[model samples]
Target: MIGPQPVAVASAPLARRNPVAKLAAALLFSVVLIATLDPVAPAIAIAVELAVLPLFGVRYRVLARRAWPLLVSAVGIVVTLVLFAAERSGRVLVEAGPVAVTSGVLLTALGLVLRMIAVALPGVIVFATTDATDLADALIQNARAPARFAIGALAAFRLVPLLGQEWQAISMARRARGVDAGRNPVAKLRLFVSTAFALLVGAIRRGTRLAVAMDARGFDAGVPRTTARRQRFTAADALLVAGAVALGGAALTASILLGTFRPLIG
Candidate 1:
């Protein structure tokens, strides 16, 4: 049973909401924010998201851990824009040789980074708080998604944590066989690639076996499948989606009032 463990916060009000509702809320919030291309709106959206983390029983430390990748991406975006952006309309902040960092370029980069985090964080929160089984069940029951697709996706998701363990095991086995890369960077990269390839092959084999096992268990037998736990869409769930829409709209409205709202479509 070495699989992905669900976030242990059963008493969290928002975390206990229907999976379909959370999914819808995240999607709707992202969609509304996507209509604007300014830093202001996304900044507001991010503020709201952080403000509501406690309601979801997600601590600041947990969110920081989960969002480190986004922070890395933001740094990359800022650096790339500062170095290579062509639209340098505003005042120059820094100039060195062929590289010029202007306020316009910096603003655009900040907007992109903020928008990326704002748009992606909700999905991260949903997946972190919601169990795979509950998500699949909600998809099948509330969203009316195909059982085959939902169950298949759930099964695949449950195996994701194993990939990390499998990679480490493969690396250790290779090291035990005297396949250490030592101090050479090139050798390290080659070793990494070879280990990844081995992991991929093992994953494919495991997936095939899992598919066959599921088939044997009548998963795809075209008969009605009963759920062990039922997911219900409640009034609170509806309010959650509505609240997301309102929050996004308010952010955009603020941006518009501040004259920072840039439409995504020209």
Candidate 2:
């Protein structure tokens, strides 16, 4: 019975909003931020996101854990930009042989990293706080999405977590069969690749079976389907989407006022 579980906070107002609202808000917020290239707007957006975490019932520590990958990417961006960026217009901050780090390059990297995090964080929060089933239901009910598409997406998303467990199980089964990489890095890499391949094959087989089962259940019948659970798009949900737009607009406005608003197209 290992499956996707809802992470929505029962007592949190935002978390209890319709899943489509959360998703639309996240999308709108991200789309607005994508129009800017400066760090200032993203910085402000990040601040706004953090400030509203409690309202969403998402703790800072939980968000950090969920967002560690973005932090790692930020580090990679800084290193890559420092070593290879051509726009070294500002004063040199560090010079080591062929490696030069300029203020301009660093600022560009920071902006990119910040923008990435700011744009991505809302989606992360939405997914983290919302249930897959609820999202699918909301999409079908509130957003007027096709049932086939929403339900299919929900099925696919539910299968994602099983991949990790299956990988572990495959690795253990292999090890039990006297397959070990030992100390050699090359052998370890080969083992990893082989394991991944095996997992992929298993996943494909499982997916094929699941698709057949769904088809047999008349999922593609094109007939109207009835829902056991109804998802309502309330006034609060509308307010959530509006808040996202306002917050994003405020961030961009702050950047423009500060004269650091770099348009993405220009």
Candidate 3:
């Protein structure tokens, strides 16, 4: 007999942890990595983050789906840096009009690529599993963020997935109605822009309605609002933050010991 299909739970232990912890971890590591232009520190951070992701229930396929765009961007960045990086002290490998590729430039490009990868991957892994509601709750409860700002931000974040879903439905409905935007590149582009504009207009209308509803419900009425589900940090949340700190510290210490640390602006 076929049993019921299992529903995927988006809330893993990592997801259960307070959203503020995740944000702080990502922000702190980004700051540390961004302080140095050296490749070694960021590379270490990326490797450590990848190693720890599975413990947080981030699967290979999930990571790949979210990472593909970043990978493409990283490649573009590498090409741009190689062509335009001003560091020319090392041996010139290739020369073109107004653009010279030197060993120094290539090295700097490598560092930049690694740094971006390090900074981007953790944020994707963290935010992909986090719920907008949980984030707003955490921000308001733990970070002392204004309730109005947190609630408004949460509403905006929640709309993104709905926007994608609505786009797909609109596209399908258009196709079924014989409003065919053929596969020609320009035609497809026009269709995309039209659909995007429609989506934007719809989103604005919905947002205005939501704001009115909230106003009616006395949201941000200059009084404290009570949440049905209070945000609370658990031991797991502490561990996650500690792990992030340790990872960044270890990377920086190793880079310093290896004499590969180079400040970004100093």
Please write out the lDDT profile of model 3 over residues 169-257, one tens digit for every residue: 98999999987767788888999999999999999999999888878888859999877778887787777788788889889889999
Steric clash pairs (candidate 3) = none
The list of candidate 3 runs beyond 4 A from truth reads: 1-13, 95-99, 165-206
Q: Candidate 1: global Cα-lDDT? A: 0.91
Clashing pairs in 2: none
Residue-wise lDDT of candidate 2 within 1-266, one digit each (tens)? 24556454667978898999999999999899999889999999999999998888988888888889999999999899888887788999889999888888988998999999999999889998988888888899999999989988899898988999999999899899999999999999999999999999998999899889999999989799877799998999999999999999999999999999999996
The better-scoring model by TM-score among 1 and 3 is 1
TM-score of each: 0.93, 0.92, 0.79
Give me the runs in candidate 1 sitting further than 4 Å from their true place. Answer: none
The models' CA-based lDDT, in order, is 0.91, 0.90, 0.81
Q: Report the C-alpha lDDT of model 1 over 41-145, residue by residue, as the tens digit.
A: 999999999999888888888878878999999999999888888789899888899988888998899899999999999988888789898999999999999
CA error at residue 106 for candidate 3, angstroms: 2.0
Model 2 TM-score on a 0 to 1 scale: 0.92
TM-score of model 1 (CA atoms): 0.93
* Top model number, TM-score: 1
